[model samples]
Target: MNKPFLRPESGRLCAARAAFSRRAARVVQFGIAAACVALPLAAFAPAAHAERADNDKPLNIEADNMTYDDLKQVNIFTGHVVATKGTIIIKADRVEVTQDPQGYQYATGTSDGGNLSYFRQKRDGLDEYIEGNAVRIDYDGKQDLTTLTTRAVVRRLVGLTTIQDEVHGSVITYDGQKDFYTAKAGPDVAGPGNPTGRVRAMLAPRNGGAAPLTGAPATLTPSTKMQGTQQP
Candidate 1:
């Protein structure tokens, strides 16, 4: 068999092409791995008002002291810690946050001294917010669940001041992803005659027609609008 002689320039060109192909393959593999990690982290992000896209905004934290444990990959914030991401905000004396290998995040907040921990998030498509306070609060980023315990009180506020709805109990659980909550009474309410106690809810009417407690007509005493319309 006769072998054909190859040009040196041709040989060098063939080697360059082979090197380029290998680099391109490695780049493609790296991109695939990056996307896999990104997708899970995006799915596990915490949402405010059932909107996941809004939750993807940057998260900023302020604290007097912070510590991170490499072994557990946990972050601890102490002494007047405040964290905010988009329209969601949390305040606590101490907060511990951990993320699992799967990119799921868990946050726990505890009160120091007599101050209660707080959490607040703006409602979706509405000029309102949901705020709560308790001795301790836990938030699961993966599940979008928030738990408040020990004198837990949650309220829906209108325009930063007016209370549209309220829930009071010893334990309260809220599903931010679903915009729903459950409240239950605990030992603090289980005193004296009220053995099993009760959870209290003060919810406003969606139609704005009746008083929440009395179910009576939502008429203002000495109706200002009526008085203004009357002929002088």
Candidate 2:
């Protein structure tokens, strides 16, 4: 998903972009706690909080300047790569992801931390980013899931509950398409450890992904011709 994780049919933004927008704000919030909110992108819970709760994780993605369909068909790059399905996500720093000769798709996440300190991932949400220092990630072809956790931190910059030193867990799950995710709070954690607040959510499936104020698509098309005098 986009850093913001909000996808528009205009295709200007992708899911990963949406994730970035929501979570990237946290890095900024640590300095200033102004009027900011977490925007959950995946299919995670706590209906209300989940609406804008972001996953706390950092990631470095490298796509082959290709479209979703291209990523699906051509295994283009020569280094580690990643991709996502309905609810599944992948990680591979120096790997390649393309259609296998057998018509099967493959991707790999390498174990390298050059400038990479931690990597965060939410099933399909943008707000939350699963962050950890040293990490070894593995992808199982079984359930189509990506797991990463190790003395990791799950932060939520949502509402009055801006968590910086609260819940700590060693595992997180992300599903790309299903748009659902769940965070497991570590044992010795505190402060809003459990997202149980009830507030009106701005974005939801029913709201068509937090649609614009237009409420509906506009039908105004401006003409740019001065030929009204002699045009057939």
Best by TM-score: 1
lDDT of 1 by residue, 120-146 (tens): 877777777778999999987778778
Off by over 4 Å in 2: 1-44, 48-92, 96-106, 113-134, 138-144, 149-171, 174-232
- On a 0 to 100 scale, what is the lDDT of residue 33 in model 2? 29
Query: How does each model score on TM-score?
Result: 0.64, 0.29
lDDT of 2 by residue, 75-181 (tens): 43324455444323444444445444544444444445552223333422344333232233444333334444433333323222222212233444433234343
lDDT (CA) for every model shown?
0.69, 0.36
Give the best candidate by lDDT.
1
Q: In each prediction, how many residue pairs overlap at the backbone (N, C-alpha, C within less than 3 A)?
A: 0, 71
Alpha-carbon error at 193 in model 2, in Å?
20
